[model samples]
Target: MAKKLSIIVVLLALMGATAAAQDAKAVLQAAAKGMGTEALKCITYSGTGGYVGIVGQGYSPGDDWPKVELASFSRTINFDARTMREEQVRRQGNYPSRGGGGIPIQGEQRLINLISGNYAWNLQGTNVNPQPAAAATRQLEIWLDPHGFLKGAMAAKDLVGFERYEGGPSREGGFGEKRNILAYTMGKFRIQGSINNQNEVVRVQTFVPTPLLGDTVEEKTYGGYKQFGGVKFPTNFHHHTNWDHEERPQGYFGVRDGGHNSFGITIANVQPNMCGEAVTVPAAVQNTAVPPVRVESQKLADGVFYLTGGSHHSVAVEFSDFVTVVEAPLDEARSLAVIGEVKKLIPNKRIKYVVNTHHHFDHSGGLRTYVHEGAIPVAHRDLVPYYYYAVMDLAPRTLEPDRLSLYPPDEFQETFVLEGVQNDKYTISDGTRIMDLHLVEGNPHAVGMLMVHLPKEKLLIEADLFNPPAASAPLPTTASAANTSLYNNVQRLKLNVAQIVPIHGRVFPWADFVKIAGSGKTN
Candidate 1:
């Protein structure tokens, strides 16, 4: 009798497993039918929305991400072909410029971005340039779309699985509703979608690689579903970064600005199966490889060198025994190139210190690379904790391993913060060569920003404060408050300035700055 009962229990367990599998499949099918995913081979959507240049804007340590205005935007995607074309007309508002110079206020700026299969390129008016990394990212976004995700899962049913998920509390309040989740793996990315009671995909979550963060989380939400021409799509779309990394290491999450990197779009209309044009790669772009690192060093003084190869620039000052480099801009590739140039320019002298201007991603992204080279980073005292906890301490080089990740932690030294308490001034000198790092007071661009001053050379090097207008460009009718503040600081300090070496634009005389900033005198 006992053996018979055991056999009955085993049969019941098998039945439960079978039922779970069936439930998963049913949920996916329901979602497909509700969203009209089966008929969604291609789609073209046009909408007007704004986008913030989050990476380009500087944040004050733990402050929320800054905003940049995007006047008009539109996108078209072909799911079957795995292609996308995005167009935007950007504008500059009251927001302060961070690094890549201030946007032109005279006219609207147009940009066109395209991704077809494995190819990605950008077109600005008449210029076309290849962007391989951006193309890869765009491809992932296409597959992760609500309708696209459903169709892809059906095709790869062998690798798809579903489970009941308790999504915790709803945004309104109380215990949130339960959801059926469809999860799958595509290449290096892991994707999951949550289906609600209406059999519609409410949200999709995935992971993407980043230079600062190892594997960053990206979440997209869909709502206001409407059927257009026999295809159902979400009218309201919102996407966020670091959405699921709340409890993870600070480095893994990157930004804690309450989804400041997030953006939304309200769809005006959708055309189904309309996209079919084949994207042709330009000859110039197809033949163009990753440009070799080339640093054109201009000797500013006896021991000072200005390193310029790309749009961004860096300064290397040779000390009595070691060297101090200012502003490690861009990513690891750019930083590695700059470092190589520094080594060649000043042989045998180790890069002992790297002075960071602010916490903007573009300016500070290469700090890790500098740290890997055994250089101490000096920045605002408040930023040290964020950099240490959110950047250095949580080091897992799994995604794109750098020199610091490959080596033991013991090999690198600690970062240095310029304590603003005992005067907002930090200096590095060897009696003969002196460099004063002072906080740019009252500047609207960034917090705890440091301007490098060579008293001996009467030269001041700064970033984003005042990028001189091009020789052919006309002077603006009004000056930015940030530029005005920079002029005031220079006069307040009473430092004899001869030349102003801006990180973004060409070096200009100090007189040019005063002329543009209105005499550095109060109105």
Candidate 2:
């Protein structure tokens, strides 16, 4: 009886393999024919739609994504030449009481993006700059499009395969339905397509590299298939930037509050075989290159140093035996540079703690680098689960491995979360010197935001709250809501701040902040 059972299991496995192979071949052929993949050389689609800029920046834990308005949008892509161009005009909307760190769309502003091969550049009005990371991201976006992936997969049959599964909930069906998946890998990224029984591609999902969240998810869905000039295409489409989490060995977790990065339009026009077009690199962009990381240190007090040389800044505070650095901004490169500088200034002290101001991608991108140096991250209590599960544990750094990925897990110290329940303020002291981390209460910019204070020095360290305008530039007539909130919090906390050190801009007097914040008096 045992032998008979073994034979039955073997037969079932063989049947499943055979079914998968057959389905894969048939589905590819059908999709290729229906989409006109054979005759297609190049395609261009244009439409006017709305866009959201860095939607996650406006989101807080447990809150829905804030909404903004994009007045106009258009995009053009050439498959054969491997180029893409986008033009957009955007504006701010009446939601999400406050905004932070993104293109301030208060008035109508025009922006353009151009990508060719491994190069990317942006043109905002007259200014042009090179964007290597954006270009890499665009390459993935081009290949992951439903029609584009189908066409590419047909030519690379060796890398493609199919699997059958019991149906899950989909737009067409309510729940517990049967579905088929076509899976493939491109470089270090994985792509999956959901195919309906009619051999039509319903959805495509893939992962993209990110600075803050590690591996971010991108998913697009298609429907309303219609024939256009002898080829079948989806008339209605939608694309989400970071709506889902990448599956990890431990489990799946996402840092975003389930918000979409952007959405697509109902394509109004499609033109094929319009070739010979390429992106021309401007002289300014062609000559520009990334500069080496440099750190400029200014001694603010006996044991405190203001580290600056780039757009973002960090403050290093020396304890009796160890050092604490505030705000690890940007990526590994920036963090590594700051770490080297800290070591030089503070001679023999090891960096024992990194105090994160907030969880915005830009500010917290380099926290992992400090973790590699065995430093505990001191952040808000609300971000504990997200930091441990999503940021530290599940993030796949295959594209660019950091210190944590290079060494054993035991080499790093545990992360520290400042629970508001026990104490709204977290103090790190060594009997002589003390640094207090306080929650910026009632601020609309971010949830669980933190600011560092040195009472003895009369110094305050913050980010994205009120970036002081340069001494030569003019001040605004009215204060922004975010700035007002930060000012009110400072007054409420009764912090005796004499100087201000901001993460984004130059250090200025506390009186300048009060002036820009529209408060009648200074501290």
Candidate 3:
């Protein structure tokens, strides 16, 4: 009797799932037909718009990504072949060049991005720059297109549908239209999209894994449907790369545009069914694989080790009882590797603090790993709110769970501590070993920029402020505004500096920096 009851429960659950799948299939078919994409297999669209220059490099913590005008933006999508190619010409005209995102564009920047099947690569003047890490995100993007969304949803056998109020955050205060939401899983990615009463795909959302935000939200909202040729297309669209927590999707978008907004466009032209044009996968891209995280450390002082081996670097300072790692860049893999190296270098000491120089995504990506290992984050005072809401508490990281995500403390404050930058300077000392953190002022880089000073060792560590030229590379005739500011600040603080250690490049003498920036010009 007990076995018969268990079998009955299983059969009932299967029936419910099948019913949901049938409903979802009908909804997808309606949307596809209404959007005039039932027979569409390929699409190409071109437009003019505004774009974010740098994804995570803002002037201040929590600030919106820097903006640039897209003189022209074009994309060609081959849904049957699972391919996409986009060309963007960006211009920095009239936009304030305050934050870093390839700011101060001299004239125009041309960018070509391509994706075919599971492979992705960028075209740099005919050179194939393989981006193995970008493959998943690029592939998922293909499904975000309105037509692509329907095709993907229809293909999934487990697709489900439900009704949701398309409103803002709250139930009482929020106001939005009612819409049908269809969702399904494609490989590792789970996709969901909203279809309005008109049977148009108004929004498409999906989660992608990242080092910093974990499972980051990527979304696109489409509107202003207009017929071009054989099918309908959206004339306007807003895209979000790192969407704010869905809890408050409407309120905290970002600065000027919205918190997570990356770019927007108003379509000028649309062309469908370009059958013969197919993006060929380059041999290099097709064979590319994500390289393993490698950390090579060089001893600079008795208890200090410089962690290198990648484009970014971190400094490990060992205290008698604890260890502090400065600059957790890239993602969990990078931070985990650096942590392993630090432990091998200095055994039996717990990591106590991770000093984040700024809030740039690349630099902050790996910070959560150290936090999971029980280290406090030392960041600029202005970064607390952003870190709490966007990075630590509110944002979801479940796509590819990191340590912190897998074992989060019951309460946010129980293990998460953002500590640093009091009165623009904070110092870490175990009475004998001391390191000073000073906030950089009047720099074009980041408003919460920090420079670490090892007073006793007479070594200054910084990021982006002054990336020293390679040993054989030539120094500039005149210092850039960023370099000049670093020099002036060094003089103003009267720091006895012997060597300048850059997070991006090898260490160089203070004298070599002076040769180009010693003019003492104030920025």
Q: What TM-score goes with each of the models?
A: 0.85, 0.86, 0.89
Per-residue CA lDDT of model 3 for 343-382, tens digit only, reads 9999999999999998888889988888888889998877
- Itemize residue pairs with steric clashes in candidate 2: 167-177, 167-178
The list of candidate 1 runs beyond 4 A from truth reads 1-26, 49-53, 69-71, 92-107, 155-158, 164-173, 244-259, 276-278, 411-422, 469-478, 519-523
Q: Per-residue alpha-carbon lDDT of model 1 for 1-523, expressed as tens digits?
A: 9999999999999998788667767888898888788777788876666555454353464444455566766777777777788777666666554423343233567778888777788997778988876766778888778887887677664444565645678655778766888887666677888888778888888877666555667888888888899888888887776543332343445533332355567777888887746666787666666677677889999989988877778999999999999998877888998999888888999998999887776788788888878788888775665566566644565556776667745634344332331267888988888899888888877778889899989999998887778878876556677778788899899888999988887788898777778654432
RMSD in order of candidates:
4.6, 4.6, 3.9
Q: Residue 106's C-alpha lDDT in candidate 1? A: 35
lDDT score at residue 471, model 3, on the 0-100 scale: 88
Error of 1 at 126 (Å): 4.0
The number of the candidate with the highest lDDT is 3
After TM-score superposition, what is the CA distance of residue 186 in candidate 1 from its true location, in Å?
A: 3.0
Better model by TM-score: candidate 1 vs candidate 3: 3
Query: Model 2 Cα displacement at 187 (Å)?
Result: 2.9
Error of 2 at 302 (Å): 2.3
Q: Taking the tens digit of each residue's C-alpha lDDT, what string does model 2 give over 1-523?
A: 9999999999999998877767777777777787776677666665565556464565464443455565666666676667777777766655455545453446766778888777788987778878865766777677776677786566554544555553457556677534567777766778888767666677888877666666667788887777777666676677776754323234443443545545656767766665435677777666666678888999999989999999899999999999999999998899999999999999999998999888777788898888778788888887665676667753446766676766636623354333331266899899989788988888768877899999999999999887778778886556766677777888888999999889877888888678778654322
